[model samples]
Target chain A: MKDALAHTHARIQPYVHNTPVLTSHLLDELAGATLYFKCENFQRMGAFKMRGAVNAIMQLSVEEQQSGVVTHSSGNFAQALALAARSLGVAAYIVMPSNAPRVKKEAVLAYGGQVVECAPTLTAREQAAQQIVEERGATFIHPSNDLNVILGQGTAATELLAVQPALDYIFTPVGGGGLVAGTILAAQYFGRNCRVVAGEPATMNDAYRSWQSGTIEGNDAGDTIADGLKTQLGDINFPIIQQGIDAIILVSEDEIVAAMRLIWERMKIVVEASSAVALAALLKEKTRYAGKRIGIILSGGNVDLSKLPF
Target chain B: MKDALAHTHARIQPYVHNTPVLTSHLLDELAGATLYFKCENFQRMGAFKMRGAVNAIMQLSVEEQQSGVVTHSSGNFAQALALAARSLGVAAYIVMPSNAPRVKKEAVLAYGGQVVECAPTLTAREQAAQQIVEERGATFIHPSNDLNVILGQGTAATELLAVQPALDYIFTPVGGGGLVAGTILAAQYFGRNCRVVAGEPATMNDAYRSWQSGTIEGNDAGDTIADGLKTQLGDINFPIIQQGIDAIILVSEDEIVAAMRLIWERMKIVVEASSAVALAALLKEKTRYAGKRIGIILSGGNVDLSKLPF
Candidate 1:
């Protein structure tokens, strides 16, 4: 797995940015811990999703590359895959929900992806993407379930650890389980006793429930402000998370909004509510991590301006 | 002047952030120029005003320092001075207009500065500040006109030129002319034929008209969306601007808003409308800078979230 992450990092090196690590004195004072934010929000497609997308498309064989790739995503992955495919000279088919934001759809189109709208449901999206794979003989890439994608996602943590390897804990927002799983792998290989933790929105605490039950669980209501963490874990990455994750911290919607506002106001950086879940989790248990060095993965900066909670 | 600027940089080195220079491929393609944005918005107190505030306060004699510093400002400078003074262990007396945003006032208070409210007019603000200076025996630091302040502000461009010396032009927003004056001096001393340009709001085109007439001028009405650039240039900095500024570009309110939105979406950074004026000017004349390398100073990022134009 470590070797796969290294290979993925090498493959995607030319395509993505080694995004900066930012620190805030105010945030550190508030949390009673020194925090290093791995700013993946400044990543190529404005999200860490770019890392997984690039690696997945680049892993295709020459024959498969000729046929191109396809994915179903209503968030950053849709744009990420389109951009990665376009940059690598491959055609991309994006299966987007019909009710997705107009701005997001336009962004995918601008990146030269062929958008195929489906009914706004997971089953419908998967069926639409499966049809594209069959008709075009293209490869279908899962946003977070594929092994290659998980390896790619792990590279962000790998990079963060490369800079600051002595961190006591690393927190990541868990949605499809790909990022957290990859982060755990990277921390296991690269970090010196660094424990991996997951941050989940209270409204969508499927990952938390799954951690306790030792099985996959679905959310009763995915009505969280942290839109990126609304999805349930998949079987492919669930085992990795179970073996490596130390704990799952659940943060309320109000905490997520407050954390987002803090980053925007204090750091003067634009980050989505989903990214704030990780920081909110740390704030929720500041005493446990006091005087410790921690790393946080700021997932993305894609947000609808009109819908700003503040 | 160069020696003074170098000294100022050293004095304020520990107090301010060496903010990152960000580049957007999409913005470069749109403007037909490679643009490097010197992000002063990420500076202490969320503005480049911190540079001047630190230098101005630090230069005081021990007796003057004991007496403290006083300034009249309703913008980023107020918070910048407050934070700078608090960091340096000096008392700060800030005279703010009552019409200033509640967020700005609260930020000043949070930074431990003593705020004295006055009527919403320049005359009242100055009178209030004057009373404080006289009664408290505090030193008054003009936001833009002070020599130390101008030298401090120049360090931003000095840092920018240190990183990229071959830039063809450097653009800065013009308000009281302090930033543009300092930037022009920095370019003159350090750059390789880099012309300094000023971006002014079209509705408040005092700087543009002043540059044309070779004399100071005042705006008929300061009705621009860029609130920070509404103030007219002062005599102390106006001559410096007249001597060194190569051009002054005027942009409409709509153009400013469009530029601001583009930055927020594409760059994934939270920059106030005032900082967007420089980019709007460059975008307005893309044809003039085709394939050229340009540097722009993003002056500040302190904004009231509730009144966001977008």
Candidate 2:
């Protein structure tokens, strides 16, 4: 698993950006911690999803690559996979809900992916993607559940640790749990002393409940601005998270927006509410991490300009 | 003037950030030109005015520095001077109109500046600043007119050139004319063949009119999203600009907002409408510079979140 991340980083190196790590003095003061932000917002396709997508597509056999890859994602992963597949000269079939935003569909199309529309339901999306695997002989790449994707996603924290090895803690937003699981492995392998923490939206606190219950928990309230973290923890990544994650912080809707605004206003970086969840978690427990060195993976910076929270 | 800028860069190096130069391949492809953005929005106080502010204060004699500095600005410069003065252990008395936003005043105060409020008029702001200089024996630093300040602003271009010395053109937003004027000098000295272009709001075409008339001009309408570029060119920088600038482009309010949105959406960077003006100019004339390598001074990234144009 440790070698997998290093190999993944090397494989994805030719494609994705080694996004810059930035620090803001004011943000440090606000959090009461010396913070290093892994700016994955500037990643290819505007998110860290590219890291995983690039590694996933590049790992396929030549025959599988020719058959192409498929995934069901309405968020950053869809664009990430599309761009990654195109760069690898592989056709990508993206299963998106029929109600997905026009812009998102266009983005996938612009990246040369074939968008397969399905009923706006989890089962329907799964079935549609499975149909692509059955009919087109395409490999179905789970956005978070796949081991290769998890290893690739872990490289964000690996890169951060490489840049700031003295980090006392690494914080990530928990969604389908790939990022958090990968970060956990990265911190454990590279950081040695650094602990991994995860942040989840209060409304959709499935990750938080799952951590406490020692089982995957489901939440009905997908009513959060962090659209990226609404998904529940996946089976493959959840066990790793349970073993390695030091803590999980749940932040309110207001906290998420406020933190997002802070990053936008003070740090002068456009980060999605999902990215803000990590900072909001740190800020919520500022006293706990006071004077400590922390690293936060700013997952993505994609936002609809027409719908700013502030 | 070339020696002055080099000296200003060194003197202010300790107090100010040598900000990064960033490039977006997506943005470059959109504009049909390779664009290098000098990210001054990340400078202390979230603007390039920090460069000028630090330079102006550092040039003062020890006795004069102890007496402190006075400036009349309700914008980034107010906070810039405040932070610069506080960094150098000098007092900053900022004269702002009473009608200035409470947030702006609070920012100056947060940076350890004493705000002197007068009536909402240019005459009143000037009078209040003059009063401070008279009563406190403080040195009055004209935000853009001072030679040291203009030289300081030139360092932004100098740093950009140091990173990418083969730039064909440099664009800057023209306001009180300091940045454009300084960029003109930097390009002339450091970039032998690079031409300086200026961008201004079409509604406030004072700089454009001044360029055509060979004399200063003023416009009554300040109805534009680019608040930073509203001020007309001053005498000191205007002469340098007249002698050095190659072209000035006028952009509409829609164009400004659109350019700003492109930066936020594509680049994932928080930049004010003022900073977008330079990109707006290039985009407006994209066909003209199809494959040219251009350097744009992203002037600032201080935007009111509550009052976002998009």
Judging by DockQ against the true structure, name the best candidate: 2
Candidate 2: docking tier: high
* lDDT for each residue of candidate 1 in A1-310, tens digit (9 for 90 to 100): 6687788889899999999999999999999999999999999889999999899989899899999899999888899999999999999999999999888899999998989999999899999999999999989999999888898999999999999989999999999998999899999988999999888999889999999999999989569999888888999999999999998999999999999999998888899999999999999988998999999999999988888999
Best by TM-score: 2
lDDT of 2: 0.93
TM-score (all chains, Cα) for each model: 0.97, 0.99
Residue A257 accuracy (lDDT) in model 2: 99
lDDT of 1: 0.92
Q: What is the lDDT of residue B54 in candidate 1?
A: 94
Report candidate 2's interface RMSD in Å: 0.6
lDDT of 2 by residue, A15-50 (tens): 989999999999998888899999999998999999
In order, the Cα lDDT scores of the candidates are 0.92, 0.93
Off by over 4 Å in 1: none
Can you write out model 2's per-residue Cα lDDT over B189-281, one digit (the tens) per residue?
999599999998999989999999999998776778899877888889999999999999999999999999999998899999999999999
Cα lDDT of model 1 by residue, B1-310, tens digit: 7788788888899999898899999999999999999999899888899999999999999899999999999888888899999999999999998888787789899999999999998899899999988999999999998888888899999999999999999999999888998898899999999999888999999999999998999889669889988788888888889999988999999999999999988898989999999999999988987899999999988877777888
